[model samples]
Target: MTELVRLTGVSKRYETTGPPALDEVSVEVGTGAAVAVMGPSGSGKSTLLNLVGGLDRPTSGTVEVAGEDLGRLSEKRLAVFRRTHVGIVFQFFHLLDDLTVRDNVLLPAQLAGVPPRTARARATELMDALGLGEKANAYPARLSGGQRQRVAIARALVNRPALLLADEPTGAVDARTGAQVTEILRELNRDGQTLLLVTHDRAMADRCAGRVVELSDGRVVASTPAGVSS
Candidate 1:
């Protein structure tokens, strides 16, 4: 498979003092693969995710996603690249409370310069597929946690990004809702979406990812096939 993400000897240090947030971390994720990065708090899981998503730059080494070197891009270029090539879903549903579900889903595509008609169609299709078709005119505050998250997922995917990065996607939901989200992610991956998820839930990782990379103290401790407990 083609490579979608690559990190070589990556390290991130906030200040001259203290240990690096990431230490010599190297990881590769191939196209259409779903990989989970899991660890306890302060293990650099978020740091790794941010670097891969182009939200932050590493102090040393390189980060390449979809054949573009993120570390080399200017802030404006990087922002454009992220808008065009990456999709991100956060633990909290970051939907705009004032916007309707359809509007929220169409926001990314609109910002990316997709035609209004095409964006609307894509948003409609995604909302329908995610079982949110009836909720299209509703605002986020009126939706259940699961429904909100589904909206977030739809918004993330409307632009058809090359890589999807989810950070603790199920962290804010109940067990049943979390499972529902996991299934959605699994189905998306099965349909050939490249996914990299950073999560603490082993069940979520096992259910949605093909491989799991475990981290501790900013270092990779294990890399194994999913369901093989780290």
Candidate 2:
């Protein structure tokens, strides 16, 4: 498989005197693969996701995503890179309550300068694929937690990103809903979406990802195939 992401000896420190959030961590994610990073709080899983998604930079070492060195890109270029190549889904579904589901899904593509017709068509296609076709006219406040999350996923994929980074995707939902979301992610990966998930939910990790990387005290302790105790 082709490598889509690479972090080599990467370390991040929020303060000059404190311990780093990540400690010389090295990881690689291949194209069309789903990899989960799992750990307790403060284990640097979210930090790793942020760096890979171009939302933040590391204090030391390199982060390369889709053949571009994140450390070398200017802020403007990085922003553009993120819009074009990376999509991120947060734990809390950040849907705009005022916007309808379809509008929320279309926002990213609009911001990226997609033609109105094209964006609408893509949004509709994704919403239908995610089983949100009937809810497209509904506002987020009227949707359940799982529906809102599905909308977020649709929004994240509107621009056809090369990498999708999900941070605790099922954190806010109940077991049944999380299971639905897990299946959605699993299907997405099966359809060739490269995913990097930062989650502590072992079940979701095992169900959605083919590989798991375990972290502790900001360092990777294990990298194993799915279903292994990571």
- Residue-by-residue lDDT tens digits, candidate 2, 124-230: 99999999999999999999999999999999999999999999999999999999999999999999999999887998999999999999988999999989883
Pairs with steric clashes in candidate 1: none
- Go through the candidates in order and give each one's C-alpha lDDT: 0.95, 0.94
Clashes of each: 0, 0
lDDT of 1 by residue, 1-230 (tens): 98999999999998899999999999999999999999999999999999999999999999999999999999999989888899899999899998999999999898889999999999999999999999999999999999999999999999999899999999999999999999999999999999999988999999999999999998999999999984
Candidate 1 to native Cα RMSD, angstroms: 0.8
lDDT of 1 at 79: 89
